[model samples]
Target: MVRILRGLAHKYFSDEEAVILFLLLVTGTIFVIWFGAMLAPAIASLIVAFILQGLVSKLNRMGVPQTVAVISVFLVFMGVLIGFIFGLLPLIWTQVSTLAGEAPRIIRELQSYLSLLPQEYPHLVSEEAVNLIYAEISAEVGHATQWLVSFSLSSIPDLVALLIYMVLVPILVFFFLKDRELIVNSIGRLLPPQRPMMVRIWHEVNLQCANYVRGKAVEILIVGGTTYVAFKLLGMPYAALLSLLVGLSVVIPYIGAAVVTVPVAVIGLFAFGWSSQFIWIMVVYGIIQALDGNVLVPVLFSEVNNLHPVVIIVAVLFFGGIWGLWGVFFAIPLATMLKAVFAAWPVQEDIPAPAQEA
Candidate 1:
């Protein structure tokens, strides 16, 4: 057993550097899995800093001083964060409160509409089934509404957490941006400098992740902004919430748009019924989605993240199960990293070239 283990280790690890890399990966995975929720703020800060680093680099390339670029980028990030908190939060809260307050009425209206189903379709739509569905929906809606009310009213914990994040994330991001090289070098010092596998993985994963992240952020903003404008022009209710959903939906490839579409269509139906406004909204929405899928995605995303749809879905399911939303958000990047690691992983399939009996 000992010999077998050593042979396997030699086949895989082969060297102290490889062993150290393996250990670091295992340790990091364990740390993230165990303490991810506890360190959410720091994790969030790191991600934000990473995203902002690109902009800082761009400014630096344009002859701006490092300090000046960092400050400018940090200020822009802070502005957006603060604006979302103060400006958008109140608006979203108002809309959400209004929606929650009207839930029972909406349910009652839906029940009324369903009542006509028997006359509309006597064979298929039975009154008994409608009653059963209505009862189930009412119960679920009641629980959901109660939960929303309780969550909104009991905001102490949430508010405190938000306060902490607001204070800590910006500070962490500022330092991270300013001391970017220093921080990277500090971490880089721990790893063995001679590991070609590690170097290859880092270079490949770093390029893919940087491009994917920056492009995704741009995609989200563009999709979200375009959606907001369209919704606002169409006089759609809950424009901010719906647009935010549409924007964020772009993050999850192939599934997000479909999922968010149900909500958009439902809300539009409730607001406009079978009116021309609803038709126009659907048309415009379709155009936006078509443009996004066909034009924007191709233009924004480089060929670096040419992952298979199945791989992406599997990664989303795996990481999302472990880390929830953040996992889902970083699913593609993590999957790409995994692919890079595997590609660079040493194998023991060397066959002795054509043994010739001399």
Candidate 2:
């Protein structure tokens, strides 16, 4: 046992640098997991700073002064952030309230429709089965409504936390964006001086993350704006809300589009039943989704996320299981970073080859 343990240690930890890297990684992961709630604001600020870095670089490359560029980009970010909060938040809240208010009516309508199923298809769907399904659905809807009402009423503390985040996050983001170099150098100082492997991994992560974030931002704007316009033209209620869902759905790749489709279809059906308007709206929505997946995504992300579909799904599921929404958003980049680490890691090429049959 001792001999096996020693061999394993020699195999993995022969290089002091590798040992240090492994330890640092373990420590960082543990720290983030342990204090994630307390550190949410800091982590959020870091992500925002990372995203804004692209604009700062663009302005700099246009021969703008660093300070001027930073201020310019920061101002633009603040403008959009404020606009979203003021313009979209109220509309979304109103629509959500509308949906909650209509939930009982929707349930009644659903039950009425289900009641016809037994007469229409007596063999396939028995009256007993219809009653059982209706009861289950009614119970679920009742629970959801109760939860929603409680959550809305109890949001004061949550609002307070949000206010605190709103105050602190921008301040942190501004400093991080302004002092990008100094901050990088400061973090660099904490690591070993001779870390080419780490540096390489950092470069890959930085490049991929920047490209992804920028592309996603553009994607959200283009897709959301287009959806809003289309829904408006179709005279759809809750246009802004549905558009927002469609836009953010890009974040989860395959899963988000499918999930949001349910609400869109349900709302549309309830509004127009099986009428031509609903059919037309659905047709338009399908077109938008198709163009987005086939055209817009390819143009914007173009080789940025070269991960396979299965890998993307697994990453989404794995990270989402761990960190909820933010984890879902960052899953692909984090997984890609892991891929980079494994690729950059110095492996033992001198492992004894399997002996020939003797």
lDDT of each: 0.86, 0.86
Off by over 4 Å in 2: 1-15, 121-129, 354-358
The runs of at least 3 residues in candidate 1 whose Cα sits more than 4 Å from the true structure, single-residue gaps closed, are 1-18, 113-133, 344-349, 352-358
Each prediction's TM-score versus the true structure: 0.89, 0.90
In model 1, the Cα lDDT at residue 15 comes to: 57
Give one digit per residue, the lDDT tens place, for model 2 in 1-358.
Answer: 9777666777766777778888988998889878988999999899888888988898899999999999999999999989989998899889877888998888888888899999999989999999998999889878878877898678889989999999999999999999999999998899889988777767776777778877888888998999999999999988999999999998778888999998899889888899999999999999999999999988887757477889889999898898898789888778876776666666653446469998
Model 1 alpha-carbon miss at residue 353, Å: 9.3
